[model samples]
Target chain A: MTEELNARDKEEVRQEESTHPGRSYRPDVDIFETAESLVLRADVPGVDESSVSVRLDDGVLSLEGRVSVQDYENLTPVATEYPIGNYLRRFQLSNDLDPEGIAARVTDGVLEVTFPKSAQAKPRQVQVTAG
Target chain B: MTRFRFASPFDSAGRLLTLQREVERASGNPFDAEQSPSGRGVFPSTNVFRDDDGLTLRMEVPGVSPADISVEARENTLTVSGERTIQIPEGTSYHRRERGAGRFARALQLPRDVDPTNVTATCKNGILTVRVAKSENAKPRQITVQAA
Candidate 1:
């Protein structure tokens, strides 16, 4: 079973993080695999549907989300923790996936990308002849 | 008012989650659980920014409805709190769970007093934004320069 994909150590992502020009962050993602599809759920707070961009090139899936924090001219900051930035992540895919069938949607700050398996990869039950 | 909690033998996993949660919760300010306004922890990572107009605080609390979140502004302290419960599909099993869920709160003491009556807050796409107007006295004013 390829269940090891779900147990991927977060440190691996950290190590894979490449230096980007602007302020970008690696969002937390959850991957679930079923018989027919592989689903990726990424948490990218402050980003809405219009600002998110998804691209697949050369077997690599890239998700980029740009979030602009609202500003209040009259207010001043007393404390800060997280800073506003973009969320970017890339994943390498195998040929078992049908890139043409991938679907994505962003809702309530979570982005879901579903990759359907190729027709040949799905399990099939063969018919037997009656004796 | 006080309450007591006892550990269950089979709840080791739950206990471990709680222990790890405590480490992050302590850095952020603490508050009472029932709809308490913001906590100081980084659980719901937040950003505090202010301009000449007012101050805005943004927090990441995905999957949480606006009704589940509560915000309170008093004097110089602003608190944000909410509960985010994980709703797992009945037939589906979770092979991995990295997202943190539960009731959380954090309170921040701003640099200046804010007008609680004029404050506004909105939650969309799992992010919470609060805009607080500074008190009249706390606002910056231009002083007349005498010609010397």
Candidate 2:
């Protein structure tokens, strides 16, 4: 059962070619919407803070991560189950989300991006006056 | 028996040992192939690397806390077990859920017996690296020759 579960979620890099050389994988992300913001968490193993870049441009959120090649230097693999590569993914954000309010940080190779909803986009209680 | 043991300055036994080590490394140690076979896309995909001195086992375990990970090396087997928990806050709706969360344990049989006391493991940037040194007998030795 564990093997089945793991086999299903293991995502392979698509054939879409990038301008850059080498391989790039689409990171697995969990996106959830809270009352105030939409949170996105992506798994990007082998990348540190300096190598990860998150950008919000023209309502498009882009994530790029580069794995440190020095880690594998001078080491020959006897057996390899996973391919080492960089990570790239993009998402189109809705206008309701404030681009300036987006906050992102990476810890333990997991990148967390929080997009706060615009003030007008949020649900609010309307005051009623007795006529 | 003497001829078999000392066929030449370099005996067949040493060559056989080198060949065996090469085959074991290339084929991922068939002696324990049934245990945690690779290429099936298992969780925390592991890769074994070799150098002159020892072997290095690396596993991708992003988002797993160091406290939750446990690594054990005994004899010629290495066991790595860990738990991954995803905390979903209350009153939240998931738009897309792709990440998996659970506990996983994988055991791998090394090609050669390793020095258990020399094993060292470290988790960095969600990647776990374990270094296992080959035992004294397993490491290649250089013998000195003297004139009679």
Best by TM-score: 2
What total of clashing residue pairs does each candidate reach?
23, 0
DockQ value of candidate 1: 0.14
Best by lDDT: 2
lDDT of 1 by residue, B62-120 (tens): 66778988988776677777777655434444444566567766666655555766789
Provide the lDDT at B21 for model 1.
Answer: 38
The DockQ leader among the candidates is 2
Candidate 2 residue-wise lDDT, B1-148, digit = tens: 4653435524333443343344345544322334554545566677778787788887889888888899886766777888888887799999999888888877777765567668899998889999988789887779998898
DockQ each candidate and list the results: 0.14, 0.24
List where candidate 1 sits over 4 angstroms from the true fold: A1-20, A69-78, A125-130, B1-41, B74-77, B87-97, B110-112, B139-148
lDDT of 1: 0.64
lDDT of 2 at A9: 35
Candidate 1 chain B worst ten-residue window by lDDT: B27-36
In angstroms, the error of model 2 at B30 is: 9.6
Question: Each candidate: RMSD to true structure?
Answer: 15.0, 12.4
Off by over 4 Å in 2: A1-19, B1-39
The lowest-lDDT stretch of 10 consecutive residues in candidate 2 chain A is A1-10
